[model samples]
Target: MKKRILVVDDEEGLRLLYKEELEDEGWDVELAASGEESLDKLEKDSIDLVLLDIKMPGMDGVEVLRRVKEKWKDLPVILCTAYPHYKHDFGTWASDAYITKSSDLTELKQTIRDILGKKP
Candidate 1:
């Protein structure tokens, strides 16, 4: 079965964009507009990886990542943010990996593949 990925972001356009990109890379993609929506999806289905946006209105990605790691210790979460390290330490949030929002699409793809242990 193809690996399933959950792309979570408050911006509808970004969510759609990432979903399309991941789909093109042969991933089974799902989009969530908020942490609450993502939590709901987690309850209903299994996901292999999460492309999580750090900044959000309710329940930010850090909190969401914490929750995911708390309940499902092995769940792989890849954080995406435009913030500097001093603003928000994506690494401290217990994510498997991170790529700045400004990062190249190729970099993000490579990061995901590396974290998933697929030959990159």
Candidate 2:
């Protein structure tokens, strides 16, 4: 089966862009506009990985990562954000990988493949 990735971002444009880009990579993609929505999707779906944005309005990606790690310890989450500083934050340590946002998505796509490749 194709790997299903849940992308959580507050920005509609980014979410759509990621959906299109990730879909082109041949993986199933799901979108969530907020942390709560992402969490809800997680409960309802079988997601192989998460591509999360860190600067959301309500519950930021860090908190979402925390909750996801707490409940689904084996879930692979990649923290994708414009703010590179968060890569150093201890809160992001639990994530499977972290990639700074870029117009090029090469890094993001590769990271996703790397993480998924390691999973059963």
Candidate 3:
């Protein structure tokens, strides 16, 4: 079965870009514009992984990460953020991987593969 990835980000362009890029890598991609919307999607979808953004309007990615970990402890979540400072924050420690956003998704893709590879 193809892996399904839920990408939660407020930026429309970044969401579309990630969807396109990840799709090309043969993974199913789902998008959510806000933390609230992502949570709603999570309840309805069978997501194999989540690529989450830190800075958002409401709830933010940190809160979402906490909630996801609480409910689905084994699900792999990669914190993809523009802000590098969040890496030092304790809130981000729960994520399976922490990656800074970039036009080049090589690192992100590799991280996803590495994390997913460990999953049964």
Using all chains and alpha carbons, the TM-scores for the candidates as numbered come to 0.90, 0.97, 0.97
Give residue 22's error in model 3 in angstroms.
Answer: 0.3
Off by over 4 Å in 3: none
Candidate 2 lDDT by residue in tens digits, 3-95:
999999999999999999999999999999999999999999999999999999999999999999999999999998888888789999999
Clashing pairs in 1: none
lDDT of 3 by residue, 57-91 (tens): 98899999999999999999999888898989999
Report how far residue 51 has shifted in candidate 1, in Å.
0.7
lDDT for residue 117 in candidate 2, whole number 0-100: 81
- What are the RMSDs of all candidates, in order? 2.5, 0.8, 0.7
> Residue 3 deviation, candidate 1, in Å?
0.2
**Alpha carbon deviation, residue 115, candidate 2 (Å):** 0.9
Local error of candidate 2 at residue 106 (angstroms): 0.6
Model 1 alpha-carbon miss at residue 116, Å: 2.3
Give the residue spans of candidate 1 off by over 4 A: 86-91, 118-120
